[model samples]
Target: MATISTLSDLYISELKDLWSANDQMARALKKITPQATNAKLSQLLEEAQTGIADHTQLLKALIANQGEEVSKEHCKGMEGLVSEALKHVLEQPPQNGPVLDALIIAQYQRMTHYGITGFGTVAAFANALQMEDDGRQLKDAVDDLYDADELMSELAEAAVNREAAEE
Candidate 1:
């Protein structure tokens, strides 16, 4: 992590941390997305990977715009989240079909929530630092993650959960 002596240092450090988080989440999604059986869930997972990539690019641009190298600090918070996701979905495979789909949603949402929190934090930091454009961009990213989470909830309530219960 950067020294973080000032708010500027902290803001840049967070950007780097989030960059690493996105990379970790994206990789985990790549492996986990295939495990999703529901067509919509699969599609959402694919789109999420793309979204993560986009967010990563935004983080890089933010870092560069801040006059820093587009480097990243390893985000241990996301590392733990990704590890839990893998543990539930891959390391100890859930039963396939709706049950696995349900598990996938649970794991995916957990990671999504983490991203939301992290991005939201940095967005506030950006705004406090008077980096309005960067703050707005980060907040927009948070909104996207929230939308994804809502869709996952809708999927669970509309079908996945019921299907899992029936199984």
Candidate 2:
């Protein structure tokens, strides 16, 4: 018979995955920020820096609260996805209308999607483990990230798509 996974173990594993993904994302965003040209994109990058810093601190606190040290295990899945996105971003730098915007939107979404999954998984684990306070905190962070993702998607549809199609 297959063994059922304990919620505590599941939570710990998911947190480690998220921690790893967040570290990688911080590195990726730092690289991509310099490439952003538009005012909106620049603002997004700056805001992302602040948000990520906050999230990193929170993750550390959570680890400590749980009587564990913050350690990042390798998140191979996220690494591959981030790597592919980075390649695309570098290969197709956004120049003027549409094309650049499309590329920016695509790249931003890739990172955001990874974060959403990681945050959601971690939140689920927290809930299962009956860590209500931790779950709420994680949920708040995830929601903010999700909002950013949604905004990026909207920008792509409203501005990038129309402009790119015309060019």
Clashes of each: 0, 1
How high is the lDDT of residue 78 in model 1?
91
In model 1, the worst 10-residue window by lDDT is: 88-97
Write down the lDDT that model 1 would get: 0.94
Error of 2 at 52 (Å): 1.8
Question: Which ten-residue region of model 2 has the weakest summed lDDT?
Answer: 1-10
- State the lDDT of candidate 1 residue by residue for 1-167, as single tens digits: 55779999999999999999999999999999999999999999999999999999999999999899889999999999899899989888766599999999998999999999999999999999998999999999999999999999999999999999988
Angstrom error at residue 73, model 1: 0.4
Candidate 2: clashing pairs of residues: 94-100
Predicted candidate 2 versus true structure: per-residue lDDT over 46-146, tens digit per residue: 78767877887787788778887677667887798779767766765656645766776687778778888888888878887789999999999999899
C-alpha lDDT of residue 34 in model 2: 69
Local distance difference test scores for all models: 0.94, 0.76
Q: Model 1, residue 80: what's the lDDT?
A: 97
